[model samples]
Target: MNKLIGKKKITMENAFYLLKRIGFYKALKNIWNHNFEKSFLNKRFEQMISIEEKKGKEEKNEKLLIDLCECYLSLNNRFSSEILSICVPCLLKVGLKKDETDETQKEVEMTLLALSEIGYWEMKRGLYLNEIEAIIRYHHEHHNLSRLAYQSAWQFLIFRIYKDYSLEDVIVNELHFGREAARELKELRESVDWKRKEERGKEAKEVIVIWRWINAIDNYLTWCALWSEELVGFLGSIVQVFREVKDNHREVIYKCIYSLKNAAESRVIKVEELLKNEAVDVVLEEIHQPKLYDKMTYECLLFFLHISERLKEKEYFESDDKVRKTSKRVIFEKIEEEGYEDIISSFLETFDSLNIKLYPYLSLKISDYFVNV
Candidate 1:
């Protein structure tokens, strides 16, 4: 039966051995919702310990040791985690002190990796919450585990919290974390290493992460508008970058322009000129098939209408009769021809909320139209 676990061939004994080797021992510990104890996991611990002891401190023996250790750890048992949880830290101290070698680094990396994998598995499968908590606490406190470690620990906690917490609680907590992360992200963005331009045919993930980070920065600026000049400056800088792209940079350009249109304190004549220019029309034409993420086409039109509405409000309030009448007629005609019911509806809702009295002539005309309808 013991030999079956080591065999490459199929057999009931081999299957049990494979299972026990992986962390089946720990999984079984939870079958009855019982607390994991040392005695219950003694066999798995002994097996893991035996590999390290037999291999000793030899560099060449590292791979063999890792393999044997992984086979034992895969049992996914709390007993195995507890045993490894103690063993790994001790091995790190001994391995680092004896030889600051690649093999030693590998030892530390693999052990932490194993722990991370187990924690991920538990979090993914929705079992052993306490065990997952222990793994996170341990990993989080360790400051030297590489960037991957920080990323891994963050991903683990987020998964568990997302699954377990209420939307309100999660949102409040994210805001706290977001503030700190935003600061760090700002520093990274300004660093020379944080290149904003994508190389031709860069992997989708890299491109997407860049897009999201830029958007996050934009969001932070808009959300913190009254608090700082930084957000506005960041938006302006991004617009400049968008203007420099030689290749078809419409997707990113559209995103930047849309964000600016929503949040810019003053309407940018430069962006307006760009939109009305022949070049932008050519770019928009090329993007005939719209993407899920491509709302720039519609947003640009909406932004123009919004600015027109603001201009109309100002003109009418100042009793500038010609300006108010001209703006209203142009906007009304466009809306009617385009059948932009949604934008028209939003405009009406905002007008209602603000309790704005339109110019008497326009007000009487809209009232008659509604009466006829």
Candidate 2:
């Protein structure tokens, strides 16, 4: 009888040891919590969807949307992509309904809030590419949806897909969404009276979002280096906007310059194109600023370096020259006239100060113009 009791005790002890080794208790707790949260969110979402389907219940729908936005905000960021995947299609469908009533506007605004929240979270915690692709595909197929809906979808797309060059190409080339996005951005920019203080303040809420979209386009250009002529034509307007708002919006200006620097480095935008838009003047203004070794300084220096190298390449100039008076020579003269020697010195100094290793190779490439001169 004692042997039997001893054997039972040994078996129980072994079971306990195995449980501890594999974290059985913690794993079970996590599974239970996940199931509970999923069930709760599912129930709440289903209730909102049912209310959304009822007609003439505008008051209820408004409250329902408000509650829905609040619920999403209260949830954890880990669920952002999942929530967006479920919510975007439904919100888009409602946005497409042909009822241009006050109720619809409220719905649109609330939906924007919900989407922006999820987008922020998704962007913060690295986007889920597959989920985002699905959203983009659905959005592209329903491109002619309401204006607000279109903006919401594009906002998410820009935030998530900007860094993925292949996906960006699919959107820009095959899908043609890039053209649509550019048109919308142009309209949005035109809508604001940027010169009027009161009007600027009134539109300030949307300014950041608009700039973000622009930055995304600029990023895409950095990768592809070439876009349709219409899209390329829009670069001038972008530079013009930078000139107008640079003083008041330093962060926005930094992003604009950074994009220009990357675009120049990519060798896609020629010096002549930049000159036509007065981009050189913009870069010069930033270059002369007191702040040294900053992002703007680095970007401006690199911009000039790339431009100078392109100027040195005779083949590029010969192929591109068409009906213009020695396009390459004229462009080189124009840039030199802007005091590029000082810009080169600044670049060399800044790079040398930052890292001893990079200075030699960079100087070799950058000093070519001075050598030829």
Candidate 3:
């Protein structure tokens, strides 16, 4: 370490050679750990930041910059605010390199991903809201980049709404982070079409990233939440969540509740939106998911009750094959799993005890089907 820096400057050629010899991944990890990989060395993240601060701009090797960008992303959310105060700006500067070689383009690709990571972490915890927004916007209107940026922006907005602050502190009345100084988020929002950007990936993990932050919204932030069709579209994309995750799992259940609550509370997730998106069927199916059946008591009940309550004056089931099939399926599977007599007794017992008066809902219809069929 001393030998590399004792000469005071690392030439681009030495930088590239040293990086390749030591290996890109090793160098990236060591840059953060302040020691070669396998040695488990010292000075750690701060040492990496210092090295990048001094040489990141001067180093002409785009690959090195790419490695550093990756290093930055890796370190995000792993450390404290002190890290963000240093790392975020440094990586953004590296991302600005424009040598235009194929290597540099790859460097820029990883660099954009790193920037997205930084933006995402910062926004999730409600720090550097404006700076993170700028990093996201720097990716411009490209679908993938804009999608990530929007998702990060959405996270920041959720925290901002939930905490009721933009998180910018005013200094001596010079005002930073004040809503006035921040960019016009609402107007800026209108430009990026979220639904147009949400395409699927070959893998579920890849596809789920598009909806990761979308699941975080509720009534406190209604702009994107109000897009009931889009929200439900995201919900349908991950119908696997309802079926796969353990019944009472907090993360999946919370996301489901928040999506429903976002629509219900925002007054935009209408029945047509639910039905068109297959969201109703998804909810109906969830009642039969053994794991969720126990974990999502309120969400499961509220979803059906609310939907049923909403439909009471509107259609009264309206003779839809889909509705009948879904209700019948829910009843059959549930009875098969937990004996017909017990299934009927448990639900009706709960409904009677809850003292609910609502009629003309899915639950009652399901109950009636069990009694007759």
The C-alpha TM-scores of every prediction are 0.30, 0.60, 0.44
Tell me the tens digit of each residue's lDDT in model 1 across 298-359: 44434454444455455333336564455456545644554444433433433332333322
RMSD of candidate 1 to true structure, Å: 15.3
Candidate 3 lDDT by residue in tens digits, 20-50: 4343333222234322323321134355555
Kindly give the number of clashing pairs for every candidate. 9, 0, 3
What ranking of all candidate models by TM-score puts the best one first? 2, 3, 1
Collision pairs in model 3: 247-291, 247-292, 248-295
Alpha carbon RMSD to native, model 2? 14.0
Q: Candidate 1: give the clashing pairs.
A: 22-74, 22-75, 22-76, 23-74, 23-75, 23-76, 24-75, 26-77, 26-78
Residue 310 lDDT in model 1? 50
- Candidate models: Cα lDDT each: 0.39, 0.53, 0.42
Q: What local lDDT does model 3 show for residue 136? A: 45
Task: Give me the displacement of residue 325 in model 2, in angstroms.
Answer: 11
Tens digits of per-residue lDDT for model 2 on 1-373?
1233245755433532342333222321222223423555445544554555454654455544544433443232334445455455545444444445676654554454345334333333233444444545655665434444455555555554534455556556654655665576666667766676443443764465556556556645655644545555555666766776665666667767876776566555655677677776688777776664365665676676666676666675424545133544555675578776776665665576544533332444456534132
Which whole-number lDDT from 0 to 100 does residue 82 have in model 2?
A: 51
